[model samples]
Target: MRNRTKSVLESIVIAAILLVLAQTFLEDFAVLIGWSWNIRKILLFTGFFFDLFFTGEFLARLYTSVYNGRSARYFFAERGWVDLLASIPLLLLSSGPAVLALLTGGAAVFALGGMLNVLKVVKAVRIARILRLLRVLKLFKQIKYTNSIMAQRHVAKITAMTVSLFVMLLFGGSLVVSMLGLPSVDQVIADRHSQTVERIVSEMPAESREARNWLAEMTDSSDLLLVKRDGTTLFSRFDNRYYTELFGPSDYQYIPREGYDFFFDMRTLGAIQSKDNLIFFVIIVVFVLFLLIYYSPHFALTVTDPIQVMRKGIEDDSYNLEVRIPGRYEDDDVYRLADAYNRVFLPMKDRSRGTTEARSSLLDFDDVKGLLDGE
Candidate 1:
């Protein structure tokens, strides 16, 4: 995984993710606005390209990671596990059993492919359910769930749907994951401020008039303002923000998490306004988001690639002390790891190479000394 190649692959996958998520979000909006834009067919068609690209990217990194000596533990950690669960099976849909079926022309592959096709049908149903969620939003006129969710009376079904959406679709299929994951907006917020959210929820009362007043303010103005424990201020636009349940439903039907409440706005017009924001604005936003999601995880690749190279080098007995990680790796824990490996193994390798030569030299010296003694 050269830096350049790693970057390109990440860019591709991230770009694909954004495109898919945008399509997903847009489709939701389109349904809300009652537009029949055929976004579904278009999204499905585009999904194939994304799936193929990501599948290749996933396999490449997996091989490189395994090749480099990543332990089962390291590989199964948060980052690796997400890549494996989210990316690999989706990839296998096209490459794994289907391809195997073609190559071997075996009944097992056929059975596997048939089962996968069934899964695909289930996936379509889930997507349809996702689209149906747009309808549920219509129920939130003032502050209520038209339908009971999770059998809880006050819980907005839409709120429940969003939570269920994230979880079910996470495991539902690759397409669902990409469609939901790409926004990466909520994901970033959750990760960056999870502790803050917990703290806020714990400290704040379930019936604080101030919090209730704030929720009213959020609804009246169509935005939620949150100042975190660190005093880092954050806000969510009613249009841009998606809502889900954080806890048992009470005054918090649409609160997505403890840290933030869903800024409810009835108009599904979205953040889009009349001739104000440009196409460039949207692109820049997407690009910035791409940079965030794109770079955060790929930084791990920098650590793993060098390890792989070292693994290959050692296995081949081609000891190269010149195997320096090209960029700034000095402060990285992985860098210290690689340095330590070289220190212990390289010296031993050098000694092994000198072993026979040293024996031969000693024999010559002994022979000379013996001859001199005899004379």
Candidate 2:
């Protein structure tokens, strides 16, 4: 029963990790597809469901660890903080801003601290559960599990592959960004606009009669009239030819006939023009995340499934070595693994048979000894 419980717990942890990765990649994909606004809503719903299951299991294990008095130090110090941050979405909804702010600040600080001790924290959590599962495998220590060696090697290979993929993504993003020249484009446009505006303002002499009269009219007009760089006007008292050309027929409809206040707002304009570039960046990030997820299952199968099979085979003597894992591999690692296990076990099986036959032969000689005594 203890072994069964441990097995279930380990399975739950693996499932949680997979779900987290899936949701993360999916959210990134949605953003890349230019559905940025909707991605948040989708992720919120997905996370709520995932958190429900993960939170329950985490709490249960936490309680068990506390009750057992096993390394409560790490649990309370590191895992406890992660549990708190993981619950932030739910907690913030129920608490006041002040309380939420305090918790949020505390969580940020704790997270920074947690990063420093991440390896230790992960080891504590994974190792503890693994140790529990190993207890159930104590019986299998006597049996020669065929694919155990292959499974261990595959786990190392998968780890290296994942790390390499992550590094590639980092460099790829940097190269793409450099080629696009978004930063340079933005800076050049902004600098030119600034210089044009400065030159226009400096040319209008404050002492000139025409300039003084123009200033007076602007101040006297009920409707606001302000000249902006590139002939753009905001709430202008006069609908000048330049304004007419820039705004077109629809401009008069949106801008009141009466002059309006022109607040210098550049951010709105920038946002309108930068939408395409933002979408491009989002797409790149999403594509990379999707590729990672698409290959993740095969990666997990190569590593996880083999170890699981070896573990189960050790526990149950009836485990079939011929039960081939589903899915085809170009490299045939799984096939090679199965072949290796069979080779190792064939000799052990023959030795066991030979010993049984020799014992039977000795039993037959027992009657010979009895006949000699009778003679």
Candidate number achieving the greatest TM-score relative to the actual structure = 2
C-alpha lDDT values of all predictions: 0.42, 0.41
* Model 2, CA-based lDDT: 0.41
lDDT of 1 by residue, 1-375 (tens): 699977795565556565654654553344344343244334434544544665565567678778877746435431344344434454444333333433464455436537654334333333332322221222221122112222222223323344335534533554655355554333443343454445455655455466555434533433233332223223433222232311111111123454444322322222231011223224434443343345323443555455665776566544455357546766677777777766776677667767743232324576688789988
Q: Pick the candidate with the highest lDDT.
A: 1
Which residue pairs of candidate 2 clash? Answer: 223-259, 224-259
How much is the lDDT of residue 294 in candidate 2? 49
Off by over 4 Å in 2: 1-183, 203-269, 272-293, 321-334, 342-375
- TM-scores for all candidates: the values are 0.29, 0.34
Encode model 2's per-residue lDDT on 1-375: one tens digit a residue.
Answer: 999988796766666655654564554344344343344445645655555554565577677767878646535432343343343333232122213223474354236436643222221221121111111111122122233444433433343344334434543453454346446433454454454334435554444466445544544522123543234332244455644333211011111112222322233222332343344334534543443344344555666566566556544443535425555652477646655555655355456656664232323567688798998
Indicate the worst ten consecutive residues by lDDT in candidate 1: 245-254
State, as a TM-score between 0 and 1, how close model 2 is to the true structure.
0.34
